[model samples]
Target: MAVKTVEDLFLHELSDTYSAEKQMTRSLPQMARAAADPQLAQAFLDHLEETRGQVERIDEMVEILNLKLKRIKCAAMEGLVEEGKDLIDEIDKGPVLDVALIGAAQKVEHYEIASYTTLIALATKLGYTPVLPLLQASLAEEKATDDKLGKLGQAAAIEEAVQA
Candidate 1:
């Protein structure tokens, strides 16, 4: 996984993204369970399924592109998941907790969005057109999930404030 060429960089990014998505599948269920709001819980669950699909797409890209991803863990995603777990442990269960969860979820979404964006750019540069649709689909889901979390977070924050 030496960074000798653009293709090497692309493969590294793709591998990182794949690891991120896999980490997400395990973390999302915990986030869902910790969510005070049923809607927020469902959102986490829904995204969990999407994350699984995303992993599959990455697997497809590996086969199509004949990529050999190194056995690397995405440290950024691990840190993000740890933060979410911290919130779940420290925060009391209620609207405030719900708001916190939304924030945590948004952080994950933002990271994924950045990962996918970079992957898309790299793929385009490498002329890896076959994998473009898969990457684009995942990016779309990440952005849409972020938008949903934003709305949910806003409402939850207002509710928490009024309650406070």
Candidate 2:
């Protein structure tokens, strides 16, 4: 796709995020299973559900915009997920692994935050009024998930990992 206009970029990004959310849904279950901490596991599970909802929102946006429902594979998310799989395979299941998982998960959340922020800004500029709310909803969820992971890391995962 050639860079012609902001609308083109917005569609490109929307497709990218749609793919990322789909990838997360697939990877998150494995992440939950790999977590040593129950809380961390539950967070992954909860986010899996949220990711599903985000996917639906993306679909709605596509329908509203009358855009083709095509997903551009987000290479960044693919790399992040591969790194997570490497962490799971290399690390022994324990506090250290849990902390590592939190770090990996936070990285994913941060990526999502940045992606959504850009999409929301583009949507607003494009006068995509109906799509703005959906983008904002997903952005809010991503930020909340990042905050939760940070609290979990500070409260327990970090200390336990350091001791281990």
Candidate 3:
């Protein structure tokens, strides 16, 4: 790993996401289990399924693009996920805890969105249209996930946190 071309970065990004998504597949269940809100728990579970699909799509895109996966460490995702897990551990049965968890989850989602957005731009500039659809699909899913969390925040206990 020396970073050189955009393609190099592209492969690195893809590999980072591959690792991050695998970690998330394992983390999501724990997140769901820790969540006191059924909706939030189910959202994590649902995203788990989506993450699995995204992982597969990444694999497909790699193959379609004829690039080898270069596993680079995703420090950003690691920190975001660690912070999320800490939120779960620190929170008790209260609206404040739920609000904190929402923020933590949103942070995770934003990280993924940012990572995927960069990859999509790289993939497009590299003329990998075949992979674009898959990346775009993942992008859309991440955006939808973010929006869902936003909606939940409006009616969620987080709203009280806002007022207070």
Candidate 4:
């Protein structure tokens, strides 16, 4: 791939995040089902729905970009999800597995936050003000979800899993 200028990098980040969001549409279900905590499960489910809309918004960005949907697969997420799966497999079922899964999920969220923040800055730099709001909205959603996961993890998920 050619080295992208600032604008190109922005687009690349947007598409990469686009792929990450799409991947989450699939990943969240597994996390939700794996969760023993009702709050965690519901959180995953809610994020799934938000991700669906995010995919649509990213599609709009792709159109604004006048580019096709392309993906540079995010190994970070794939690796994180895989690690969570491994932890899930090793840990006994119950709150322990749930906590482990939440930890893994939060890691994924953090990765996303970084990606979105970068892209948002790039978008603003590239003078794409219209796209900025769309990007910021998704960024905010990711942060909120992360916060919820943090709270859930601290409240019961962590303690429950550690006990197991």
TM-score of 4: 0.92
Instruction: Give the alpha-carbon lDDT of every model.
Output: 0.91, 0.93, 0.84, 0.82
**Candidate 4 residues 85-120, lDDT tens each?**
788779766898887887888898899899989988
Candidate 1 lDDT over 17-71, as tens digits, reads 9899999999999999888789889999999999999999999999999988877
Model 3 Cα lDDT, one tens digit per residue, 24-87: 8988898777777788779889999999999999989878988888867678878878987888
Score residue 123 of candidate 3 by CA lDDT: 81
Listing every candidate in turn, what is its Cα RMSD in Å to the true structure after a full C-alpha superposition? 1.1, 0.9, 1.8, 1.4
Rank order (by TM-score, best first): 2, 1, 4, 3
Q: Against the true structure, whose lDDT is highest?
A: 2
Top candidate by TM-score:
2
Clash pairs, candidate 1, are none
TM-score of each: 0.96, 0.97, 0.92, 0.92
lDDT of 2 by residue, 14-130 (tens): 988989999999999999999989999999999999999999999999999998755479999999999999999999999998999999999999999999999999988999998
Question: Which scores greater on TM-score, model 2 or model 4?
Answer: 2
lDDT for residue 136 in candidate 1, whole number 0-100: 99
Which model, 1 or 3, shows the larger lDDT?
A: 1
